[model samples]
Target: MIKIISMKEEHIPQIYEIEKSCFTIPWSKDAFEKELKENPLAYYIVAESKGNILGYAGMWKIADEGHITNIAVHPDFQHQGVGTLLMQGIIEEAQRNHFIGLTLEVRESNIKAQNLYKKFGFVNEGIRKGYYQDTGENAVIMWKYFKE
Candidate 1:
């Protein structure tokens, strides 16, 4: 019984745990705090089941475009449709806001995530060399445009 809902302050600890579990360079709790409290452009959502958060995703809406900041699901929750639910929530949010498109960057080595984005209509558009300082990994830029 997973449900996608607006991310709130109480979800930070769980979201941070998922971030640490999923990424080599995880964002700090303070960063998430600022984004949730101080950033007007940022919109985030969490997937919860039986009172426990299983995943989270966030984006920053700039003008007519939405830029995905991050998306992660607990390893225990991976492959269980948590990611799909989170992505669906983000996409719906973008469309409701009348965004012309949505974009995100994935680690070049992360084929799974790339495929997930592709499944949601995001197409690889370019690359950012050494985008990840932790491993010097390149990033694959992807975009999904909405019909006008």
Candidate 2:
């Protein structure tokens, strides 16, 4: 049973666990804390099972653009619709705010994530060289335009 909810302070430890498990380079607890605390445009959602977080997604709204900051699912929960739920939530939030579109950067090697975004109508827009600091891998920029 998966539940999606607004990311709360109490969920940070579980979120951190999923983050580290899902990504080669995970964001630190301090990063999440700061986003939750200081960033008014920060919107985050978490997928939980029984009380443990299984996945999470976040976005930063700047003017009319919604920039996805992160999205991940626990390895154990992969292909179980956690990523879809997290993304649906993000899309709903973006629509609610009247954003023109949503955009994100995924590692070029992350085919699964790229495919997932494509399923939601996002198209590749460009690339950023050396976007991943730890790996020096390029990032694929994808965007989904939402027309009201």
Candidate 3:
């Protein structure tokens, strides 16, 4: 049984492990630490099962919008609804905080992630040219609106 819980400092190590497995340019432990310790606008959630982290997601709640920072599921747990659970956690947090909308950027080549976001009502808003430093890939900006 997987449960989505608030991401505490203790969860960073496992979240970092998932980040490394999921991204070409993974965030450093220090970054996660800072977000958990000092970033006032950031909020995160983790999916855990039997004391093991299966995935994690985070966002920055700025004004009336929630900017999704990252979402990742351990490769072994992908396609098993872990990502969806992480997303649900983020969305619930956003709604609870009265966010008017949510936004994220995804690699243009990552169709699976795009599809997942689409399932949650995120629509293509625009493109950010050469947004990824690692690969110089354009990012597809997506948004999900909750307010008029």
Backbone collisions counted per model: 0, 0, 0
lDDT for residue 13 in candidate 3, whole number 0-100? 82
Clashing pairs in 2: none
lDDT of each: 0.94, 0.94, 0.93
Those runs of model 3 whose alpha carbons end farther than 4 Å from true positions after fitting are none
lDDT of 1 at 24: 86
Error of 1 at 105 (Å): 0.7
Per TM-score, the best of the predicted structures is: 1
How does model 2 fare in lDDT?
0.94
Report how far residue 80 has shifted in candidate 2, in Å.
0.8
Q: Where does candidate 2 stray beyond 4 Å?
A: none
| Tens digit of per-residue lDDT, candidate 3, span 1-148 | 9999988888888888889888999999899999989999999888999989999899999999999999999999999999999999998888998889999999999999999999999999999999999999999999999974
Model 3 weakest lDDT span, ten residues long: 9-18
Clash count for candidate 3 is 0
Rank order by TM-score, top first? Answer: 1, 3, 2
Superposed Cα deviation of residue 34, candidate 2 (Å): 0.9
Candidate 2 per-residue lDDT, tens place, 1-148, comes to: 8889999989999889888888888899999999999999999999988889888999999999999999999898899888999999999999999999999999999999998999999999999999989989999999999988
